[model samples]
Every structure is written in C-alpha cells, then in structure tokens.
Target: MSRARLSPALVVGAAISVVFVASALLSLVWTPYDVAAFDIGHRLEGPTAAHWLGRDHFGRDVASMILLGAGNALAVSLVAVLLGAGLGVPLGLLAAARRGLIDELVMRASDVAFAFPALILAILLTAVLGPGAINAVVAIGIFNVPVFARLTRGAALSLWTRDYVLAARMTGKGAARISLEHILPGLASVLIVQATLQFSLGVIAEAGLSYVGLGAQPPAASWGKMLADAQTLVSVAPLQAIFPGLAIVVTVLGLNLLGDGLRDRFDPRLDEER
Candidate 1:
C-alpha cells in the first residue's frame, strides 16, 4: 500500500528515539565516572566540582547513575519487547492461518493473560521469581505477549480476507507460504505501530517494577531503581527523583508520539486522508 512521508511529529519522535538510543549506547562505553564509585567526601553534594549531577546519599555520582540507568532501562525494554514480539507474532500468525482448534487455544490463552495488568503480573512474578532484572523482563514480556498476540491476530484476520490472499489460495499457496508471502507484508505497518506502543509500555512497566524494588537491584542503576532509592530524599533532595522520573516520562512520550506518527504515515486508511 502507498503511504505519505513522515510528518513533523514523526521527525521529532525520531530525534528523541535517537537521543535515548545514543545515550544508552554511550553508557555502555563510558560515563563521566563509574556509576557505583563512591567518595564519602562528596556525599549529598549538589551539582558542582567533579560531580555534574552531584552525589547520592552514598556519594555515588547521580549523572553517572543516570547514564548507566538509562542503559539498563533500554536493555530491559529491548529484551522484553523482543521476547513478546517473537512469541506473540508467531502465535497470531498461526491463529490466523490455522483458524480452528489451534486458534481457539491460542486466543483463549491470550485472553487469560489479559486478565492481569502488567504491573500485577510483575508483582506476582517478583514474588515467585524473586526481585531482579531478569524477573522483571519475564513479567513484562509475559504481559506483552497477549497484547501483541491480540493485535497481530486482529490485523492478520483482516488480511486473511483480502483478495490477494484469496488469489494466493487459488494458486495453491500453502497456509504458511501465503502467510509469509502475502499476509505478513501487509501487516508490517501494524506491527511497527504496535512495537512502538509496546516499547513505551515496556518502559513504564520496567519503571513501575523497579520503583517497587522488584526491578533491577541497587548499585546496578536502573531508572526505576533510582527513583525508588530517591523517594525518601525527595523532600530534601528533589533532584534525586526528578531526573530519573523525567527520563522515563520523556522516553515514553517519544515512543508514543512516534507510534502515532507511524500509524498515520503507514496505515492505508490514514494514508487515504493525506
């Protein structure tokens, strides 16, 4: 299907996405100082001297923690997104293609998953799996699967009824071949939109889990964990919470705007408006 070029919203979203991606990548190579490095002399110091964002209660550099924390947040989001998309997309495709017992089973399972919110799932998983980064990933990923599965299935269902799909069937294209060759291409725009939406959700979920202490542990520096650590200090050291909270808000906002722009740019219905 034909589509219009990117709009202003998309351009801004792209810039924001690039910034966060670069920040995460840079954190892998270097931060101004080691995120965990502490000096008692610098404890609770405001932004000045050697520390740009100042030091935490333990004298660890806040700016450094932010960099490393951004990296961790990105990492968790990526993994959770990948896991959800990988598992959910195939199920959606299969449900659309198979459309019988298999579809019934898959859809039912996805519905069951829908009963629990991502945060609730995270809390449950944390209880079962115990607090850590991996557990957070799994919890978020699990919640994502149902969302992607339902979205993909709906999109694929629409495609399955298309004339091209009927034509493919007339040519004796097998279900798998028709799905890959005819259906998937049509669904790409939908998947891209869904992915960005999910990415934003993943960020929120990660932060929520971390805020509750079920996310990345202390000293490892996740944005959520940073907020958790700084909650008590907010009345006195507001910067401790503000920076990490702003990071989460900005990142999620960028993803959401990007997702909306993508839907307007690529979807055939929206393209007709242009």
Candidate 2:
C-alpha cells in the first residue's frame, strides 16, 4: 500500500502507539520524579515548572506516575493478549481440524466463558488470586481467550475448505503440520488485527478491574488505580482523574484505529485501491 493513501486514523494511531511505547521505555530507565516519593506539602499542586503534570494527593509527581502507569498497563495488557492468543489459537485450530466432539466441546466452553463480562471475571479471579498485576493479567487473559478462539475458528473454517488445504491433505500431511504451515499463515492478517483490538480491550478490562480494587495494588502506579485514588479528590484535583482517563482513552482509541486500518489493508478489494 502506498504511504500517501493511508488513512489519517492509521497515521495518528501509529504515532500514539509509538509515543506510549517510548514513554514506557523511558520509564524503565528513569522518571522525572520518584513516583513513590511523598511530599505532603506539595499535594494537589497544579502543573508548574517543578512538575510538568503537577502532583497527586500524596504529592507524588503526576507525570512520573503517569509514565510508570503506562508501562504497567501496557505490560499487563500486552502479556494478556499474547497469552490469550497463544492459548486460543491452538484450541481454535484443533476445533477446526477435528470438527466433531472436540469442536463442540471447545466452542461450547468458549460460549460459557463469553457469558461472564471481563470486569466480573476479573473480580472473581481477584477474590481467589488476590489483587496485583499478575491477577490482572490472568483475568484479562482469560476473558480474551473466548474472543480469540471464536474469531480464529470462524476464520479458519473458511480456509479449511480451500483448495490448498485439500491438496495438503491429499499429500498426506498431518493436521498439525497443515495447520501450522498452511492455515496459520492464511489467518495472520486477521489475527494481527484481532490482536490490536484485544490489546485495547485488555487495557480497558485491566483499568476497570483496578478501579474497583481488584487489580494492581497500591505502591504500584497503575492508570486505573490512579483514577481510583483521584476519585475522592475530584473536586479539588480534577487533573488526577482527567490525565489518567485521557491516557486510557487515547491508548484505546489508537489501538482501535490501527486495527481498523489493518482490517482495510488486509482486505484484497481495499488493498487494490492503495
């Protein structure tokens, strides 16, 4: 596709993703302020030369915490998406290839999983696993499994009957080999787009879980946790809530935009135009 023909949303989303990735990488090296350090005397201070994004209730620098929170959120969401895709794709391929009892069992189980909303699932898991980043990853990862499995199965089924797959079967290739070599490559574009969409959903799920005290615990800066902490001070410190909320909003928007653009790019009819 020609670069000039790319949608504006694609450009913006790519820029946003790059910005967040850079901020997260920088947080690994250093933050402008010690995110955990408390200076009660500086509490709720507006943005100033001293602190680019001001300070929170505990007088922690908002910019530094925001940067750290981006890293935490991205880590959980990315890992969750990877876990989901890893587990889901194989199950989906198995179901598609077997197409009998195995398919029925897997698809039915996915249906049962889909019944529970991500937030509810997070809360339930949190009760058993305890609140923390790991729990958040597990909760979101589980919620994502059904989505990926269903999407993969639906797409794989269409390709299963294609001429190439039939030829592979005629050549005595095993189901596993055909799936890995022939099937997976065909599903790459759709899966890539799905991954982007799922990453956004994972972020939203993690943030919601944290907001309700079921996610990343205190002392660990999380965007959702930051918003939760800022709630009580909304009247006096609206920036606390506003900044984190904007972070979530922008990140999700960017992922969605990128996913949409990818969908268009992978479609043969649309690709022709570019």
Candidate 3:
C-alpha cells in the first residue's frame, strides 16, 4: 500500500487539530485568567502583559474566553457526531442487508430528515426546550443522521456483493454476523473520512446556532456568541470579532485538511493515479 499517511496535509492538519484539542483540555484545569471575571474599568483595553489577546467589551480576557470556547465547541461537536453515528449506522446496516421495503423506507426517511436543516431543527428545539448547548447537540446530531446513514448504506451495498461477503453467506452465516465480520470493517476507512468532514460541519453549525441565541447560554463561552456580542463594535474593536472568527476558520480548515489527507491515504484507487 502506498503510505502517504505522513503527507504534508496530514502533518499540518494533525498539528492544528492537536493544538485545538490540547488548548481545550488545558482550559479545563487552567487558563491565563478567569474568563468570567469582568474588569469594567479595564474593558476594551489593548493587548498587554496580562491580556495577550486584549480584552473584550466587558474586560474579560480574550485568550481565556477563546480557550474555554474551544472546549465548548469541541464538546458539542464531538457528542453530536457520536449521537449521529450511533443511531445512523445500525439503521444503515439494516437497510443495506435487506434491500426491499425496509431499505426504501429508511432512505425515504433520511430524505425527509434532509428537508429540515440544522438551523430549523435548532430553532424548533429552542422554542420548546429553550436555547442551550445540549439542545444544539441534539439538533446537530439529528442533521448528521441522514449523512452517515446514506454513506453507510452505499458502502455496505457494494460490500454485500464482494466475494468475501458472498463466501460468508455461503458458509450459512447470518446477515448480522456476516455484516459485523465482513462488511463493517470495509466501511471504516470511508466512514472515518466522512466523520471528520461532518465534525467540521458540526462545529460550524454549533457556531451558527449559538449566534442566533439558540445555543450555548450566557456565561458559557462560545465563538458564535462572541461574534454576536462583537458585531456592533466590529469597527471599533475588530479584535473582539477577529479572534473568535479566526478560531472557527482555523479549526474548520484543520478538520477539512485532515479529512482530505485521510481520504487520500485510505483510498487505494488514488494510488494508481499518482
């Protein structure tokens, strides 16, 4: 197998992703300053020895808030992705294993789900449950369900026709057994790549939801909420918006790069072209 696992994209992406995760985890124990601490007298102060990234309108340490925000964003996105995969994978396997009315129904249901974007779902949830990070997770997770289901079903369908799968069938192994033994493993590479892409989307969606007051309540650091708070003052305190905005951009960029690298490394077909 062509081993491009350590390609430039992978190295850079991994570096960025590692930083994102490390900084987030670090915030759990320590940050430069208390993000919630407000020094009204020092509000909007320029970057100094204490505040590396300057201060927000409330004089909260920008760096500290960004650090905490990373944790919040990561938690929401990670849980949402897990929730989606947990439910979608099984449904997809079942549909692929028995491609009749069940398959049609599963796919049709996914289509219906696709009709409602995460924004709509988040809004609906907010109306009933009020806005919060947990609600954002559910909304994002629901949106991701059809994505994994479709990908799994497509990959599984092809695997079902493979010689190994046919041999397993001939050996009288049940569909469930054959799938777990033969089909699921084959889907891992593609699924991992898709999961990475979906993760980036999840972060973006969470930010969008938070901006509209449909996610991450007050006192909880969130990049989108930071952006929302900074909007009116962008012309005067551009850094307020710049820091969080850059965080989102860089985070998403790293994830997309990682997904692309993983796709290249995992897809053997690309070897021939190279």
Q: Which candidate gets the maximum TM-score versus the true structure?
A: 3
The sequence of per-residue lDDT tens digits that candidate 3 reaches over residues 146-260 is 8899999999999998998999999999999987888999999998999998888888988898899988998999999999999999889899999999999999999889998
When 2 and 3 are scored with lDDT, the better candidate is 3
What local lDDT does model 3 show for residue 15? 84
Comparison by lDDT, 1 against 2, better one? 2
User: Tens digits of per-residue lDDT for model 1 on 1-274?
Assistant: 3455667778888788888889999999999987666788867789987777888888888888888888888888889989998998888998999989989998899878888877888789887999899998998888888888888888899889999899999999899998889888888888889888888888898888888889988768888888888889999899988888999999998888899889888766766665
Better of 1 and 3 by lDDT: 3
Error of 3 at 76 (Å): 0.3
Residue clash pairs of candidate 3: none
> Which 10 consecutive residues of model 3 have the lowest summed lDDT?
1-10
Against the true structure, what is every candidate's RMSD?
1.9, 1.8, 1.5
Kindly provide the TM-score of model 3 when superposed on the true structure, using C-alpha atoms. 0.96
Tell me, by lDDT, which candidate is best.
Answer: 3
lDDT of all predictions:
0.86, 0.88, 0.89
